[model samples]
Target: MQRKVDPEGLAAAAFLAFLATAGLFYVNIMAAIVDGLVSGLAFTDAQAGQVAAVNTYGAAFGAAVSIFTIARFDWRKTSILCLVILVAIDLLSILSTTPMTMIGIRTLHGLVGGLLIGTGMGVIGRTANPDRSFGMLLFVQFGLGGLGVMFLPRLVPLYGVAPLFLSLALFSLVTLCMMPFLPDYPPRSVAAPIKKAGTVQWTPLVLAISALFLFQAANMGLLAYIFRLGTESGLSRDMTSGALGLATWVALAGPLLVMVLGRRFGRFPLLLAGMLLTLGGNALFHWSQFGEVYLLANCATGITWGLVVPYLFGMTAEFDGTGRTAAAASVISKLGLASGPLVASMMLGGGAGFAELINTALAALVLAMLLMLPPAIMLDRSARRPSELLPQGKVTA
Candidate 1:
């Protein structure tokens, strides 16, 4: 019933994903700028935290919107609208001088950001290799985030954070450039089970999804707050940035390794390996006071993240399906995105220090690890076998 998968279409999906995540990374930079803006406006840290929450709330709501939004509107129109909304909002962020305005703009951002990530990711996942797609998508996230991080910090001084978002407006414009060539709908060949498998269980997939939440929550938390923590511990802004910007790029290794091995293994093992690397990185950052130590920690984090995230997405699409599968991920992604700052606020503030943050993260990660054991026991041997893991995971009806 379906036709052959288009390689070019898949490639376009990856590029579009790159751009969407660039917007997210831009927001990440904006998070820092929001703090700076808050300090300038005399808002308490609590108020600043609230401003960040506005974006998360928007994202969570927007993600929910995607489930209905995509179904009602065509992907093409939806994408263009999201970009248009983001462009206006980013520029507005530049104009914002007060907390309320900032909150309003970020809330808008959360909404649009959620839509872009949800839909854009769905496109790529449907097109690319499912097994490798997971690693591949995260690969794009890191690359885009890196590009945004490099450019946003430089732009913030010249035009401010809002203007930096305007730059995202420019990047979103690029997504349009690819649109004429990008695939509008999932290929007819993408086999989706309609009845939710009345008797067909989804325990493995559920476990994988849960693992995704834990991993992302843990990873994003470090990404959001580590710069502040490192700076507090005597690292300069540039040093922290380098760790994030340069060292974070090192995360590419996981995916690259997966490219070679994805055809050879299961997503869960790769996921497990990624978790170990993340654990190691966090430990390194915890023990070392030196900037280089944190630098090394980021490198480890980067590589593992690159692989783990894509693998998770790919696995999700396989167990479930891509269209709405990506929509489901947005729930945890949004929570983790907002949770990082809030968790940090609770853990590190009031002179309670980094101990709480670091300890809590390590503890959660352990819990995440514990969560994975069930899948190991329940999934099939081939499902667990490395050589059997297909890089792609589209439903083959």
Candidate 2:
């Protein structure tokens, strides 16, 4: 039988997935957010950092909770509730006078955002082409996030911190209005006998999760310090900032490739190539005293950053029909992101130079790529096997 395609449904799902993952993108723009708090709210740098940390920690915890609840609730209804609550929290944040109050409000906001994002990923896992969906997720995030990072801080100087909170509130409200367009995305039915027989492949799942964690940690660690690395490498602040911004916009090509190519070359080959480029990109930091090398390094790393993440998410999502694995991976991702800057801070505090920092990042990336290989190879092998040769109810693409 020929199936009718719901173009509107596909568009709505893609839009919601983009909106729902704003919490993760907010981390990508943490500098502007922290600066807004410091300049507009008159909070000290330490207090602003505390609020951001609390928010990230809260989101991670919320994603952990979602790992258990994804299959129990209606995704559309839950998403609507989360959006409403998030809007309310953002509105409430503007009224917070004390650092503690702001921290508390942002924590609540993060929890709701986390739930929304986790549910969104679960829905993506259920889709026929999660790689493309995840590619779209990164595409929207980088597109909007580049704008935010570039311009949001300018508003803080003129309009106070209200614009930051207002922007977030407005985004959630818009997503809420679009909620009616979303499919219900009810939980899928897993094969009961496979569950009973305990046939799940734990090894590859664990490896993939660990790989994602390391990938995030390595990238965030380098990103958190990229500005300093650039300046110390003899580049001016303006030049570094310009290069970073342009790199961000140029990085859109990576996800665009994923969306267009899908899995044409298989995950393992794509991942290996991406990681190799990442290694070369990091290595370029050694010659960053030359302005062109610095710019190229940032652009290279940025493109690979956009490339590997969605593929990793897509890989993890393939492990389970129920999407629980993807939810759990979201939690790991948040934790890794949160930990990255902390690790970087410790290294800098210990009097380590940028050279040492670059080495550490390179090591983490190498480890991440190694961790990803076994699972990618396993999935590749599974894909090549004939359907009849595989165990019943255990087929994967």
Candidate 3:
């Protein structure tokens, strides 16, 4: 007998996916904003870097808040409120003439964006196949981000950065209409286990969370500077944008690949392979002098990112029964992303070039590789256990 697909679940996942795109718009367009601020507002690189970082900082705080209070409100209504605030802040961002004001406004925007992300994650986490749900989320994020990277640069030359902000606001407003389709809360089976927090395992959970933070910090640290790297490598603006866009689209393949494989080879092997691929990609970026080689490096890194992120989030969900840990992991992940650009900016201070950026990325990748080892070991050990003997969420392949 064929099982019927749940329209509500599919709708909810689509909403969460779009929410992911809207939530990440600022980061995806960071390069353009930096250029705009430096040219339009006459700000220094450090100042522009702060403008980019504050949004993620605010998101970290908002995710923390959501971790504790998410169960108290209706997800649909909460999302609507967050979306409205996001639109308001994105619009207000255009009025800032000073870095301090831009930071202040962006901070507020990040908070709301974080809340939306947490809310969406909460909804998607409750679904039966979180791996696939998160894959959908990444697919939407990269797909839309690719489009933005491809076109936003062209728009920037004509209309400047205000339109980019406005476009994001408009996108959020559109997502608001999808809120009605999302689930109000997780399933009772998933939510009712809140009192068992005392019994939750801490070691693996902590390791997994740490791995996520380090990996993102490493990935975003490099990615935050990819546009700069392209230009420094002698690519024209249009060529750089095209490379970024193409890489993002290529990244979509990672999640789709995960979906097709579906635990066939187990998580540890896939995770390890993804990390190794990331290292190689960074190496390629470091060595490549030609524009085409640099773009290929982008594609390599994109594929690596697509391959790993879902499993990391899935592992977090597996470790915690109540989903608070997953929410906390989101916070940590955002903090890593927020820190990445700041770290890159500091490294690139006063006319440093691609060598500095590549070196920093390599260092970060090494640290991420180290942090991932313990979790991979744990997953490997768990995969050896009999299916009936395994804990509820510990079943790997």
Using TM-score, give the best candidate's number: 3
**Between prediction 1 and prediction 2, which has the larger TM-score?**
1
Candidate 3 lDDT, 1-397, residue by residue in tens: 4333363466566667786667667777676666567656777766777777788888888878776566788777788888988988888987778888888888889888988877777666566776566666776778878887777766666776787788789889888877665554454574342334443457877877777887887787777667666666777878888888888999888888788876678787888888888888888886555778878888988998878877887777665555556656778889988887777767666677768778777777777767666766666566676342234443232
lDDT string for model 2 (210-251, tens) is 999998888876776675566668876556656766777888
Candidates' C-alpha lDDT: 0.62, 0.74, 0.74
Which segments of model 2 are wrong by more than 4 Å? 1-10, 34-51, 68-77, 91-103, 123-132, 154-162, 183-196, 225-241, 285-291, 317-324, 348-356, 386-390, 393-397
Clashes of 1: 19
**Candidate achieving higher TM-score, 2 or 3:** 3
Clashing pairs in 2: none
Model 2 CA lDDT for position 200: 48
Q: Give the TM-score of candidate 2.
A: 0.79
lDDT string for model 1 (201-295, tens) is 26766776787777766666556666556666788656666667776467677778866776365555666777787788888877546978878
Q: How accurate is candidate 2 locally (lDDT)?
A: 0.74
Q: Worst ten-residue run, lDDT, model 2?
A: 388-397
Residue 43 lDDT (model 3): 76
